[model samples]
Target: MNREKLPVLLDNEIIEIRPDQSLLTERYTDFGINFINNLEKDQPFFFYLAHSMPHVPIFASENFKGKSKANVYGDVIEEIDFNVGRLVKTLKEKGVFNNTLIIYTSDNGPWLNFGSHAGSSGELRGGKFDVFEGGYRVPCVILGLM
Candidate 1:
């Protein structure tokens, strides 16, 4: 199989030619954390963090790689979870945790063709390109802003 080449872009410009994809989750989280940290306490801001992992050619940082029993796929998810925790901690430290609104969801189901490298849609039939419920069904979580 041919490995996909992914590039890192900033402001619609390529910033790095060969960024370590494994650290992308942490990097995205850090960007969000820093943005929040530098904001005025009373100022309203919006931060959007979109991760690229858990997709084809998945990867996990050294801290998370090989740390899960569910193989590389699990490692990638664990890394995402870790970064999300860090983001939440930063929000709480900034005293905006209670007022912040967090919405988390996947764009689509996993690619079942990748075998263990892809996520499971549980008992849902089909995935990704298929027209079954598994292809469109996804988990969504909304928190805070109460």
Candidate 2:
């Protein structure tokens, strides 16, 4: 039997920030907007905004709540879209829109069983934990730098 020593687990107080419970999207949007607004044209900067949304237990801010016809997932998506639009506007206002590179992508397939809370993988098969194409065949949208 091949016995491997397991790494010692550190005692850490993990703070749970539930994607659907906290203002995660709003906070990330603020961070990106602030960074873009304060960036200097004389120096190059790399801003990466990662948002956790449209996921399970998804929670949209009060402004976006019940604003969509789809449901929580749709509302969350709309919130993200609004934030992205704001980011683009900021970039354009800063005159760095043409130089910035924005890449939007997802980590994996959706949990179809999550119903309204889950995103669609379209015609792709398998999702989330499955080993199918849908599991890893996520969407990627690249803009700005051509």
Candidate 3:
């Protein structure tokens, strides 16, 4: 693996990440766990986790396999949900649950026409692009905070 191949400029700094774990589908929760586990307990902290779930590949994780009634996509969502639940549980276990702030959401509406694994924007118009309601409209869930 060549380190130079994965370089990017961020805030005037060159940043690099190994490609073996570069799947957009493989980020978020997978890396988030590491971040949370290494947190220092003496100071209050903020952790924002965004999942790339129910997104592309529509792959069902092992625990969620054959369980979702909505097919492959649904299973992926359940996996996302499960991982999030795990994070919450971990916080509670650490006695920081009440002091934590958790906000859950998607970056955009469901993608369309990228193979057969399209997602609905829940009564919105159009897909990920377009200025329609769907493009700018998506679900947002707030949890564990003010």
lDDT: which candidate is best?
A: 1
Global lDDT of each model? Answer: 0.88, 0.79, 0.66
Q: Using Cα atoms with residue i matched to residue i, what is each candidate's TM-score against the true structure?
A: 0.93, 0.81, 0.72
TM-score for candidate 1: 0.93
lDDT of 3 at 6: 53
Query: Model 2 over residues 23-138: C-alpha lDDT tens digits?
Result: 77877788789988887665799877767687676889998988888888889999999989998999899899888788999889998899889887889999999899888999
lDDT of 1 by residue, 50-133 (tens): 898888778899999799988899999999988999999998999999888999999888899998789989999989998898
Model 3 Cα lDDT, one tens digit per residue, 1-146? 46456543345775655332223333556566666777788567766655545666456656667777766677677777777887787777777788877878777777876644667766677878778888768778877667
Q: Any residue pairs clashing in model 3, and if so which?
A: 125-134
2 against 3, candidate with superior TM-score:
2
Candidate 3 off by > 4 Å: 1-31
Model 2, position 95: C-alpha lDDT score: 90
Model 1 misplaced stretches (Cα beyond 4 Å): 1-5
